[model samples]
Target: DSNNDLNDSEQEMVDIEYMGNNNDTDSLGEYDDTEVNVAGNESDDNDKLSETFDSLDEEQLLFDNGDNDTDDDEFMDDWTTDVIQSDCEIVCEQNMILVVLKKCRGLISMIKRSTILTLYFDAQRKRFKKALNLCYDVKSRWNSTYCMVNSFIVLREIIENLFSNKHQLHITQQQVKKLTNFELTSADWHVLLVLFSILKPFYLVTTAMSGRQYPSIGLAYYLLARLRNFLQQHNKKESLLEKRLKQLLLKKFLNYFDDENEQMELIMLHAYFDPAGFAALTEIERRSVEQTIKKSVADQASHSSISVANTLSITTTTANSENKPNANRNVKRNAMNLFNEFVGDIQYGENRENESKRAAIINEFYQYRKYVIEFNEKHEPDAGSVIVFWRTYGETFSILKGIAKKMLSTPATSVPSESCFSTSSALARKERARLSGEHPCSSVFLKDKIKL
Candidate 1:
C-alpha cells in the first residue's frame, strides 16, 4: 500500500512545477498564507493542478521518441532511476557500472550467473527451452564478460521468467524486495543491447588473437583498425552509455597501436607477409609495408656485405704483416694487386646479384598483390592459414618466401608460451611429486609438437 502511494506521488510530481522559480515565489507569497489553504480556495488549487497537467501533456507532445532526452527520460522513469544530464556525470556513471560488472564476475556472483546457465541448459535438455545457455565470466577476461552479457541478452525472456516465478524458486518476500532491481526492464535491456553492439567487435578481435594454431599477429593491425573505425563511426550515434564505452575502448586501441611502439613495425611486417591479411589491407597500406620491408632487407644486406669485406681486409693485413718486409715486397705488392682485383670482382658480382634480387623482389610483390586481388575478387574469403598459402607458393616467390618466413615467425600472442608454462605448472602440482624438471619440460614440448 505504501509502495502504491509512493508511485502515485511520483506520478503526480511529473506534472508539478516542483522546481519553483524564486521570483514567482515572492509574488505568490504576497497573498495571505491563511487564504491559500482555505476550504473556499480548494477549487482554485485543483484548477491550477489541472492546468499543470494540461501543460505537461503539451510538453510531452514536443518530445519525439527519437530524441535522446525523451528516450533517456522514459528510460529513467522505467527503471525508477535518476537522469545524468552532464556528459562527465554520465561517463562517471558508466565507469561505476563497469566496476559493478567486474564485481559481478567474482566468485559468489558468478554462482548466480552459473545458476541461470544451468537452468537454461537443463531446460534445453528437457526440450522446454529454446534459448542458449548463459555463460560464466572470469574476472581476468573482458571477452568472457562480453559473452556472459550477450548470452543474458539472447536468453533475456527466460531469465526474466525466473524472477517473475519467484514463488517456484521459494524466494522470500524480503529477498524479492531486495532483488527487485535485478528484474531488468525494457529500458535496461535496450541499454544492454547498445553495450553488446559496442563490445561485439572487441570480443571478435580477442577471439581471433587467442588462436593457438594460426598466426594471429598478422590480423592484429587489421582488427585494431577495424575497431577504431567502428568506435569512431558509432561514437556520435550512440547513447551516453555506449559513447562512454566507445571512448574507453578507443583509448585502449590507440595505446595498443601507438606509432612510436616497436611492436607496430613487427605487426605491420607480419600482416604484409600474411596472404589473407595482405588482401585485407588497403593498397596504400600494402605499398607502405612492402617499401618498409624492402628497405629493411636492403639495409641488412648492406650490413652483411660490409662485415664480410672488413673480415677479408683483416685477414689480408694479418698475412701481409707476418711476411718479411723487404725480401718479398714485390711479391707482396703483386699479391695485394691480385687480392684487390679478386675483391673488386666479388663486390661487383655481389652488387649485380643484389640488384637482380631487389628487382625480383619488387616485381614479385606486384605480381603477388595482383594475383591475390584477382583471386579474392573471384572467390569468397577463406579462413585458412596464411602460413600454408606462403608455404604452397614458397618456390614460386623465393625472395617473398624468405620475407614470409621471417614475418610468420613472429608470434601474434605470447599465449602459447604462457600455456606451456601453465601446463608445466600443472604437471608439478602434486605435492612431493617425484617428476624431474627435464621430464616436465619434455612433456610440454611433446604435447604441443606431437601430431595426433
Candidate 2:
C-alpha cells in the first residue's frame, strides 16, 4: 500500500548530487534507479501498476509540467555557472588594469594580457572553491619569483581544466594553438617541482636571516652548514638534471666559503659563541677555533700585565705550626696518615709556583670549552640564546664575552636598514613633509616599542 498510494511524480523524482569527479562527469544529468515496495492487502502484482498508469494522463506522468522537481536543480546549476563566470570576468579585467598600471613583461605579462585566458582560469578556481589569484614576480625579489612559480604549481589543475575546456570558454582556434604550447605537461611539472624544491631552503634561509627581532649571526652560520649538508645528501632516484643542479649549487657555495682559513676563522668565531653552533662544529674545526682564540687571548693578556694564573690561585706558604700538638705516648698517629700529610705539604709547595701567561691562557680556554660543552648538552640552543648565554656568563669569561659582544651584534643582512628606509619614505610623504627629525624618530620609537 505504501508503493501503491505513491503518485507517478513521487515514484519518478529522485535527488541527484553532483560529486564533480571524473566518474560522475559522464552522467551529469541522469536519473538514478529508485525502488519502492508494495506492502498492502493489495495484489503483489503488475495489476496495481497497470491500473495506476492507465488512470494517469501524459500531462501528469511526463514530469514536464509546472510542478517539475528537476527545475530548481537545473536552474541552480545554470545560475551558479553564469554568476561565477561573470565575477571571474570582472576580476580578470581588474588584474589586467594592474598589469597596465605597472610595467610587466615575460610570461606573467602575457598571461595577464590574455583577458579570455585569465577569465577562464579564474572561473575554474571559483568552481573548485580555490579563492586565490595568480601572482606576478617582481624584479628585485627572488621570494616573489618563488611565490609566482609556487602559485602556478598550486593552480596547475585549474589551468589544465581551462585548457581542456577551450571551446566551452569561447577560446578561438588560434588561441588554442598558442595555449597548447604553454600548457604544462607531466615533464614540465616534474621540472618545476624539482626546481622549487631546490630553491626552498634558500627562501627559508633568506627569510630567517632578514628578520630584525633576533640575532642572525649564529643562525646564519648554522643554517649555512645545514644547507651544505642538504646539498651533499643524494637521493638514489635523482634525475640527470637534479644531479647537475646539485653539482652546480655545491660548487657555487664552495667557491666562496670552503677551506679558507681566514674566512672560516670569522665564521667559526661567531659559531663558537652560539651553543648549537659550537655543537655543530667538527672536532678538527673546534680545535682550530680554539687555537685561534688562544692566540687572541695571549695577545690581550700580554698587554694587561695581570697574571691570570695568579688571580685564579690562592697562594699559601706551608708554615709549620708552633702550636702543633706534641706527640703523646698514649695517642701515637698511624704511619699512613703521616705519609698523607707529607704528600699534602709537597702539593702545597707546588701550588705556590707561579704559572706562565701562555700556560694560564691555555688553562682558561680549556675551562671555557668545558663549560660550553656542558651548557650545550644541558639545554638546546637557538639564535636568540647566544646573546643571553654571553650575557649570563660575562663575569666567567670576561674577555671572550667582550669579543662576542662586538661580533655577534653585527646583522647578517641589511634588511633592518632597508625597512627603516621604507618606513621613512612612507612617513615623510608630501602631506607630512614639514615634520621635524625628532618627530619621526619619536614616532618610530613609539611604533616599535609601545603596544598601544
> Best candidate, lDDT-wise?
2
lDDT for model 1 comes to: 0.56
> How accurate locally is residue 419 in candidate 1, as Cα lDDT from 0 to 100?
76
- My TM-score estimates for the predictions, one after another, are 0.59, 0.56
After superposition, candidate 2 runs with Cα above 4 Å error: 1-107, 138-142, 237-240, 259-261, 301-360, 378-381, 420-452
Whole-structure CA lDDT of model 2: 0.57
Model 2, range 1-452, lDDT digits (tens) per residue?
Answer: 43234333233321222212454333322211111122333343234334434443431332223234323222122233312233443433334323432321223333443434444444455555554455655434446546656666777787666556554433345555655555566756666666678778888888878886657476577788988988888888887666667666676677667756687678887787677777778888888887887777666655453454344333322222343455643476799878976774333323333235457556667777787787777677665767666666667864566777777777778986688788888977853676778667665655576787
Please report the candidate that would top TM-score against the real structure.
Answer: 1
Residue range with the least summed lDDT across 10 consecutive positions in model 1: 11-20
Show pairs that collide, candidate 2: 1-40
Residue 69 of model 2 has an lDDT of 38
